[model samples]
Target: MIKSVNCTSFKIERLQTDNGAEFKNTFLSTFLEGCGNIHETSIPYEHHQNGNIEWMDCSISEISQTMLIASCLPKELWPYAFCHAAWIFNRTMHGNDTIAPYEVIAKNKPSLLLLCVFGSKGYLYDHLFQKDLSEKAIFGYHLGEAPHSKGWLFWIPDRKKVLKGASVKFDKNCFIQRIPASTSSLSLIQASSIFDGSMILAIEKQDKLVSSVNVSHDPIHVTPINYREALASAEANEWNIAIEEELTSIN
Candidate 1:
């Protein structure tokens, strides 16, 4: 969970969880204590205390399940569908918010250029295992976005494995019929329309559960944005020495 937000500048000061046995364990308690963080639990039998998270969980489940039903994919591929659902959830606007959660964290709007219909048929370049005379590209099903990458994940039925590929072409109009299912009842809009603008307030309330962890005596280091700032910073002497060394090496 910590790794999920490592890309951002947010510092986690507290953790809130339900009174599950997994969260009440000694190791987790000790870990939080070591990090000088607080751990709080929701009151027993009060589901409203966790309304935002509960609602989000339900939305993700519905979206993923809907994708599975539409794609006619097996239940075993639900993990990939969940990943795709989360990717979409982050990119999409929630409630009445003008900006997405991803925009808040990433400081920019997400690009939808690479997004395609779930279970869309595509061909992935097989540079790694391609024989001299074999086909360079192989057929596959669109899975989801690759973690920490700009590529997409593809499920090659022939190889029976999921492969990450950068260069690929998707046929948005074509969907694999590995398993046929009725997609009449499934709709992505249902997930987005379930909650109103009030849910944003509930999510903001949940944000109070986390805070910045900083000590008074700890010195904060701010990176210099430009050469002038670097010369005027507290480490100006070190910067000057480095600059002189670089000039000397160039000479």
Candidate 2:
């Protein structure tokens, strides 16, 4: 749970849960209370009070399951599918927000250009220093992206470890499915994208049973507009070269 919390980019303010003894313990109670947080308990037999979160959990589960099934991956990989769902759920437009949760927190427009179908087959170029032209690359499954380094993460069978790198080519046609935009699912997707007090308020009011551990975000790093400018400059240079070639050909 602590590890999960540290993975987020938000500081949990208050916590609310059902009347579970696990949550009513002295250590957790004292810890949260001492930290000046309001810990509220739900009324007995009050599942509706926590409907929002329950619904969100269901949505995440469904998304994870769908991804796994779509990719024909094993059941043991449900956790990875969950992580992928969460990642996509955050980047997707939520409710009224014009931007994604990643954009709101990172303070930049999130780019989906690097996104690959979850669990799709991918290849990473070989880094081997061998002089002979041996096998140039290895095959792997696209796991997810690194939160810190923004590097691509892959599950390499040969390596039996998750590897991170920037160079990767993906075969996304393996698994192609869409997240249906329904009323409830849309709300959950958008609401979960938020990390501000607004989201907490919504969860607390529902008396949700989750110790959503959110971590503090480090820094906001955005690709400068100069990148787009550079693309335009390159296009202009190519046009000039084309024009000069045409004139030289005519001469």
Candidate 3:
């Protein structure tokens, strides 16, 4: 599948694989070589040699399995399941570097405006509605992220819609599987309160005693903020200090 996509885009470069029977045939080697591509084989029994592909496959498998269990989806649709898995995984930030794969590749934070809870109830708008269409919304499982658009991929069982795009809604009751199983072991570090200087610390302090650290100064608030609230909270400390000074002067 990957080979087909690569061939279509004329981006076929080095095709690396383990010493498997699939790529051992002379025909496969000749075809790849004819396309001016290098077919490199990794060392036998040494999985670390092909760490990149190995890691990717493991990530996909883990995510797909989790989604399948969560949604009770069948095995035949594992391809779609993995696509959804890959999309979400890409959106997630890596623990080692604190950078999402999408951001790393695209060089920007992905917009979650169209993100919705996985396995949530949503209404699919029907275009061909002559009479008053009372029942528009259908029950669906929020699978993952979308490929082409800024929308949540929903699996609507009622309408038999698979991989449907929908708007993002933040309801407490919504069943969202935003936490992918592959990243379950990963830990997110929350920045603590900033001190007098611009030094930042994690909410959970590390045992290691480092002389100095340069943590991310970026704000990490997750709630959807209105313009007024956002502007007001921009200088949180300044507002508090000003209020304190006013009270002190009055007293």
Candidate 4:
């Protein structure tokens, strides 16, 4: 939940839960109150208001089940599998719509060159190296895209670790479909930019710009225009003689 809040651009104005004792605790209530957000409780049996979250949870459960059966991976690794699932979902086209969520937000279609087959084996080079000695790389699964950059993401199988916020460089010649021995561990990764109130405001501004442009008929032309071509015919006549003289000299 903290990670979700950290990654998203929207502020959670309130958190409404059921009359479950876990949520009704004094400490949790005090925390919510101190955060200056409303905390409302719904009736124990009625689930209509919380329908959205309920549906989302069910969907995740279904996806996890399918992935587990297809990949033969354990349930403990479902969280990592779900991250790859989300990346695929964000990139795939849906029902009569050619554009994906990534395209809509970035205003350009992202290339799939960075994508790797999920669960496929790959190698990840460690960041550090010893003097006059060749450093070793770890064997891992080619997961998906880096959340913050235009690169492939990997999950080191030997170490049972997921490499976040880092790019992968594939060795096409020696690529295989199995994990290898673990090497020296790499440094901990961090997000390049943290989500803040100001960044959320900026995203809102971008949304407005996209919405405004979507409704217009005129194409937003970004190509550079030649000054000579842009000039009126009458105005261009003044420069015609100069051009003619230059051409004649070449002839």
Off by over 4 Å in 1: 4-6, 176-251
Which candidate would rank higher by TM-score, 2 or 3? 2
- Tell how far residue 245 is off in model 2, in angstroms: 74
Summarize candidate 1's per-residue lDDT along 1-251 as a digit string, tens digits: 47645878777898887654345545567889987889987764466787888788779878998898788655566678987999999999999999998998888889997787788889999888678888899888888887779898887755556788889988767655764344222234432332133645544443332212121232463543234545667778876786687567434
What is candidate 1's CA lDDT for residue 111?
93
- Count of clashes in candidate 2: 3
- Stretches of candidate 4 off by over 4 Å are 1-13, 20-22, 86-117, 129-136, 144-153, 164-251
Q: Tell me the tens digit of each residue's lDDT in model 2 across 17-129.
A: 76543465455677787767788776544667777666666677788887887865444545567777888887888678788877877667778776777777888876764
Instruction: Give candidate 2's error at residue 40 in angstroms.
Output: 1.4
Per-residue lDDT tens digits for candidate 4, residues 12-33, read: 7789875443454455667788
**Residue lDDT tens for model 3, 45-147:** 4678899878887877787777666754434445556676777777887658688877865667977665544344455444334367455444455566665
Model 2 poorest 10 in a row by lDDT: 221-230
TM-score of each: 0.67, 0.57, 0.52, 0.47
Better of 2 and 4 by lDDT: 2
* Clash count per candidate: 0, 3, 4, 0
Evaluate model 1: give its lDDT.
Answer: 0.70
Q: Give the CA lDDT, 0 to 100, for residue 211 in model 3.
A: 13
User: All candidates: CA RMSD in angstroms?
Assistant: 21.2, 23.9, 22.9, 25.5
